[model samples]
Target chain A: MNSTDQNAPLLEVRNLSKHFGAVRALNDFSMAVRPGEVVALAGDNGAGKTTLIKAISGVFQPTGGEILLGGQPVAFATPQEAREKGIETIYQDLALADNLSIGANIFLGREPMRKAFGFLPVLDRKAMAEAARETMKRLDFHVSRMNAPVSNFSGGQRQAVAIGRAVYWDAQILIMDEPTAALGVPEQRKVISLIHQLKAQGRGVIFISHNLQDIFAVSDRIVVLRRGVQAGERKISETNHDEVVKLMVGG
Target chain B: MTSTSPAQPAEKHVAPQADHGDPATSLIGRIAEGRAWLFLAGLIICFEIWSRVAFGATFVLNPFNLQSIAIFAVAPLLLATGQTFVIISGGIDLSLGFIMGLAAVIAAHATNMAGAAIPLPLAMLAGILAAVIVAGVPGVINGLLISRLRVPPFIGTLGMFGVARGVAFLLAGGTTVPVRNSWFALLGNGRFYGVPYLVLIAAVFVIVMHYLLSQTRFGQHNYAIGANVQAARRAGIDIRGHILRLYVLSAMCAGLGGALYAARFTAGAAQAGEPLLLDSVAAVVIGGASLFGGSGTILGTVAGALVIAVIQYGLVFVNVEPFWQFIAVGVVIIISVLIDQAQRRFSGGRQDE
Candidate 1:
């Protein structure tokens, strides 16, 4: 059950489970995210945080679960299917095409196309560059060279580009897997701020992170998992870091 | 949620503007992008000067030599042009030469019966259709194996090489198939407005391929698929289908080259494509396309084929032994691949973007 407002949750995972051979990666998991909410996912290694995220984003299919979007049940056969359902996953690796221009990557699979002669449509590069610049501006993210390859971008900037790609496509649920790991203190902070910006725009977020400070900084609520099961769920205001830390570790 | 600002984004850390899109990537930027263009130009200049000094006049690009060069350059240029598509997609077609040879044999037999039994124009169409079917069908098979069956591109294409060659030999009965159609001869050898039709055809193909590689979504997908297959797939790019189509296009390009060869030579033989495989690959690499994949242009390839022409003309002009041409091409391939390796190292092998 959800809170008493009666509006449908933006994303709801009910009785979700994933099994890899004999390993139970996720067991009878359930969580809900409402509009404009940031739900932090916290756990140690092998705790099923990543597995659940992958299940939600269509990287891995949940062996048993009902993923309901706005009260309508959905099944994602591929990652593209999830994206079509307005769910975007920013994987740990960033998945940016390093060789393509920032604008190109921003509009990778879905480039602005115009028919040249007839029937054979080509990329309208001018349109792509303009749209990319526009979307980045909306995110308050700036890059001097929009036409340059992403391989030239710094680690953080590349992450920003990856996030921008989801935002540009109007993804309703942004699922970030380890959004802040391997980043500097400042780069990490930038990502945290970007998450706030995403929430401000009324998009729901499922943020998975090992950093307690980062999780505490942005989440409206925290869901803790341990050993492939839901350990606990707590409202940020109702619980402290020590309680969440204990839930993540074990008894 | 917390209202505090996130740390400053890392958007301002522009390093030394040594990247491809920088102004430093000017005409020198363009030339610096490919080893073949840089070395080929220097080679031509050196060959021209040496020819002028040694011979009474500049025999390097005289009309007689130029015509011969154009004729010889046609078949290989077509093959290299097609190879550009495959290589940029991080794939290769080792069977290209044999595919062309097979197309030529089919076209020869088809055209031989055209004037007497079929109409001349219809015969030409039949000849072209035969070439396309023979070459394109196998190419599709190669694509299926590589994409659907998970066969390595090198092995699949190499297997195609042997198969196509064997079929060509069987089709020709270990001999040349004579072509007698005068129209075929004209297209092969004749010219309008003082340009060899063969050269003209190659130039037109260059423009078409350049457009295909640079101006279309298909071209971008090729780069994307080659640059990073996983990223491409996650982007929802149909990698398997795209790769299948790419192999077909590659084989068909060789088919077109074979059709043209049969037209020009007035005969088709299994061994016709023996030298072409090495020559076309050399020309492609020399044109600035990487064998390691994800970067190449048809313009560069055409220029590369021209480089071979210049070398052949220059060597003959300098009275170099016939065997020296083979040695010279071998040396060129080695040097070009070396330069490509150095480029890969310096660019960190990640500039396909």
Candidate 2:
């Protein structure tokens, strides 16, 4: 890919709109995420940040408009399809299976399988564990053991594993929904560093958060959504938090 | 900022270091999470003791009697496996017993209609088909009502319980339908490699179910749905279709179990499995499956079924009245739930601390 191609936005939504009965969850919500940039999505609760993320991640098909990946229009019928197109989403709850081990949760839905020699095929646990360890290491995740069940991990470590799973799957566009909503200050810093690392790897990241301080620290650009419509998009260096908040409130 | 960073690192290190004082702490966590399996072991030990005291030996250890113990355990084992899937998906199929009974009656009627005229394979196929259809219809209905209409699975399956049992009685004229096919008798009673075919079938089901629950995408979705349906949906899982399939799969297993029962008995009574409803649930609960859903294993269900079987067999070995077996099963079920609650409370405390 040329510099233009490399710098080009990986995902672009144009005039997207979605209506849930009498309410419009999104309206003309257009945004673009360039490669190697962390775009912060900041809005008040119910300001359609989630709705926009869902639409882009293919959880809900937009009632109107086009989504472009690499400047070509693409439609995703399912989240799996979106995932196949290299869009990985880590939701607020992290979607970890508590009963399963950290490795299992990371490799859930897609597992490594060795060829069947006779009547039985085997799960390649060694390969999976090795890959899980590598992925965790790359993300700078320090945990007691990869064999331990995810329930044993603290909130921040769990979040790291969730992010690692997405990154390991080669997600080109990472959408994180409130990555540090409930974490303490140190944990928040850990996640922020991870986000920076994700952006540094030349992948586009859409960071949805209510914390403007964290947003300013990490985001190159900030997009504001208000009642299902795009309020504005501003370079993080140019706009103050009050202006962003005002735009988010539709003032 | 420097003091805070160092202090925070020290604090984080302290908590994990404290946990490291005993390498057994993590092992304890693992064991606690697997407390259901532990409880199962305890049950087995208790039964072993009772059997030795009553019969002057461990009855299950006797090679000649092992087949009988297995034969008696297969039906409930199959039923428990099916129930585990249903329950793990955050639903209960109360219709399981009735559906099994209905399947048995259907299979019997089919076998009788064939009555030496049809080829043995055809007759068996006919019986299996009849049972599958009988059990599958209600499953589809349950799935539709629960998935599309958003009815509570409890109400839908309970309603199915009544409907299926009533249909079985109507078809059998409120009595046991005699098995006229000789092959059906052989199928139920025959042995392969000294193991009863019915037992083999149940074992196969356990293996298949274990693979499905542990290795497949459907299994992951089932756990996800049970853990949190909304989250599963948000992850792009087809919650409705998956839930429908789960109910159908469960019912199909019940249907097969019923067929096995009819083959074994050479007759299909309307109330054949009526008493097994609670027993089946008891088996799964005893195996360590949560009633609230999201966690369980086929092995657990198998162990649970065997536990029930051992309790029943142990009672006979000890010359205790059969009626007391029911009370024992009831007591075991209560204790299993209490143990699960205690485990949860312990884990909850750990999480809080």
For every prediction, compared with the true complex, DockQ reads 0.36, 0.16
User: What is the DockQ score, from 0 to 1, of model 2?
Assistant: 0.16
Global lDDT of model 1: 0.82
Clashing pairs in 1: A99-B353, A100-B353, A189-B7
- When summed lDDT is taken over every stretch of 10 residues in candidate 1 chain B, the lowest stretch is B1-10
Which candidate should be chosen as best, given lDDT against the real structure?
1
Model 1 C-alpha lDDT per residue in residues B86-140, reported as the tens digit of each score: 8888888899989998999999988877667887877877886788788898899
- Model 2 clashing residue pairs (backbone): A27-A228
How many angstroms is residue A121 displaced in model 1 relative to the true structure, after the best TM-score fit?
A: 4.1
**Error in Å for residue A145 of model 1:** 2.0
lDDT of each: 0.82, 0.80
Model 2 scores a C-alpha lDDT of 0.80
For model 1, what is the alpha-carbon lDDT of residue A105? 88
lDDT of 2 by residue, B1-353 (tens): 11111111111211121112245565655665565567657766776787777657876577655787788888887778888888888899899898999999999988778656778778877987889877898889989999999999999999999999999899989889988777788889999999898888888878989988876667766876787676566555788899899889888888988898999999987787888888888888887888899887788777778778777876776788999998988888788788778767755565422
Residue B33 of model 1: what lDDT? 63
Top model number, TM-score: 1
Task: Report the number of the highest-DockQ candidate.
Answer: 1
